[model samples]
Target: MNFTEQALKKPRALLLLGICFLAVVVVLGFFLKNSLISAEDTDVLGDFVVRRSDNATSFFTFVSSIFDPLGTIILSMLAAGIFWLVTRNWRYPGFIFGSVVASAAFTYALKFAFHRSRPPLLDHLVDETDFSFPSGHVTGTSALLFSLAVVLTLRASSRSVRILTWLAAALLVAAVAASRLYLGVHWFTDTAAGALVGTGTVAIMSAILFSQTKQIPAS
Candidate 1:
């Protein structure tokens, strides 16, 4: 392994990353909470993103909304389960599972807190009227990818394998986020916020899970 790779493999590196990630999340959340809402920016972002989702009028709505959501959750769960099954490590999947719950909870909390309105340029692919500050799809997809990266980095033996795994995870996250915007379902800002919150959620979850795992002795 190279110097950077070796350094990253250390427990201290992971722990430090967790600490910094959590602190960043706290700061970002505060910024979002206090920043003034801009209708002009919201509309502009919504318009630009909705262009990607111009297929909103197509029959793909069912596939985009239903299949995408189901696929994201199911894929993440399956990946986590596969890891645990092969490695006989339950805590690994546990971490991924915990990330999902936390991401969803925090996403909803921020959604309601912001009370942002949906894009008026286009109708939603699926009915959604409550709040639309941050796109849940983006956040959910981000969490899933982040979880996959963490799992792969933990278990993969080779540098090539780890790099490939992370690349795939990042691509998957981007695709999902793009799909949401391209379907005109979410504003650009919404997806951006989702990505931020989702990433932060994964980091925080990792830290919490590691702390708990530390309390248990290795068998």
Candidate 2:
């Protein structure tokens, strides 16, 4: 392997890095919730969203609707099925399942800990309840897509395929985060924290699994 790849393959280093990132995100998220709930940020963004065309609003509404908790679970199940079929191994499938679960669990835990309220009813395009410092939909979708991308890229043979897969996965995650903002369901910081949490879960899981196998999959 090249020097850069060699450097990045240190499992311990990667694990530490992931933990640090997750901690920073959680702390930052706690602080940002205060500013996000203030009238300045919410009012400005809400006003901008109100002016958008009906079709555009509907599109984001659809995007956020399909990325809810139930939808994320279904996607994870399907991913597990695909992982099993492709690799014919339980190891990667189990990893995917665990990572997805971890993502959801942590997202909710953080939400409860913060107890931050969602955007005002007046600003909401779709009504939602419960704490919303970090968006559950964004977290789960990011975890599922990002983990799938990492797994697929590791299994792929061609450099071009790996690059394309990473790009596609990134775009999907960004779109989901954007939907949360466009639909006025979450603040920008909420989605930001969600992305960090999701990515950190994948990173920690990957480091652990990689340490066991050296390579992610035997195939």
Candidate 3:
């Protein structure tokens, strides 16, 4: 099937892409996050992540630094409240809240299971943590924001509004991932892994929700 052809018309051709992308990400993360990397490659790639950090300076790093776990949590709470007030739908709120909780928990569990260490910091701008692979910031924010994006796009009527919302959501996700890497707290691969995991979680939940959409009565 020509996805591009379908995407131009159907738009939600994202459903199929989401499935394949999630499946591949899950499999890749399973191996990379757990299996022992070669000492040479580990040293090389680890150095590359660090080298990417070394370029950071006064404003670029700070400007690129767009996320904090605490901020995301607070925002999620406020967004949840607004969402509840506007729609009065409980399950969707539950889905958003549940996605964040489940994604965060799953992230930490993977971190502990793999027991990957934080990037070897040359200069610390902020507090450091123990296990660093699959950054909590990236996973948490992406899970919440992307899930909300999916919900909004699904429910929106105006084509322009839906497209704009999705674009903004994608930007937010990218910023969150970038912030983790620029801060030197997470390796590039760690951010990649976190994004993949977060996106995969969103995809899984979307599939479930889409399946159930048929049973829902029109509002």
Candidate 4:
């Protein structure tokens, strides 16, 4: 197999890569805890987001709400159901469910461990009560959308279709991450770390699931 095939097909390599990503998130949290990045940096960015136009605020608020906890659960289940209907393979849906749960669990654990506070409440455009080292919204959205992208691309016959699937997923993930910053509920590091955690969780889960199965269905 070529290098790309080896990287994608080897469970060990994928798991190791996923672990490396998670490790980076831990190191980033430590830096933030030590004021290495400085709260002033976040505050400056938060101020900029908070002062944006009302229309921008409205647009982001809508975008962020689509991936709230309830929304995430609903969308994830819907995606899983559709995958099962199309492929008739439990592994695809199982991978989706597993990635979402693992990503959410990991994100919450880090939030409590880091005890990072959100931006000032007065600056917040939406209500958020949790510690915000890694944004739960970004984590959940990234996990779900990226997992879907992986599965869709794997089954897609055309290069353009695969590219489009990945591009769409990436854009949605980016929008969700931006929404957190635009809403003044999370620092830039929070969203960045959340994306890492979510993507890593998907990588690890996909490796585990694919290793158990013979091969993903082509159609």
Among the numbered candidates, top lDDT falls to 4
- Judged by lDDT relative to the true structure, which candidate is superior, 1 or 3? 1
RMSD of 4: 2.3
**Cα lDDT, model 1, residue 200:** 70
Collision pairs in model 3? none
lDDT of 4 by residue, 16-88 (tens): 8799989999998888877755766577566667478989888899999988856876788998999899878
Which 10-residue window of candidate 2 scores lowest in summed lDDT? Answer: 1-10
Candidate 2's TM-score reads 0.88
Candidate 4 local lDDT, residue 178: 84
lDDT of each: 0.64, 0.76, 0.63, 0.82
Q: TM-scores, in order shown?
A: 0.71, 0.88, 0.72, 0.91
Q: Identify the runs in model 1 with alpha carbons over 4 angstroms from their true place.
A: 1-71, 121-126, 211-219
Error of 3 at 171 (Å): 1.3
Candidate 3 has its poorest 10 consecutive residues by lDDT at 1-10
Evaluation by TM-score, superior candidate among 1 and 3: 3
Q: 1-219 in candidate 1: lDDT tens per residue?
A: 332234333545555665565455456556655776467546654664546434544534543564343466776688778877776777677767767667777778877776766655465455666676577777777787787677667645678877888788777666666666555566666777777777777766665665554342121
Once fitted onto the true fold, the runs of candidate 2 whose alpha carbons sit more than 4 angstroms away are 1-8, 33-40
Give lDDT: candidate 2, residue 45: 62
Task: Write out the backbone clash pairs for model 1.
Answer: 52-182, 53-182, 53-183, 53-184
Q: Which parts of model 3 are misplaced by more than 4 Å?
A: 1-30, 33-66, 213-219
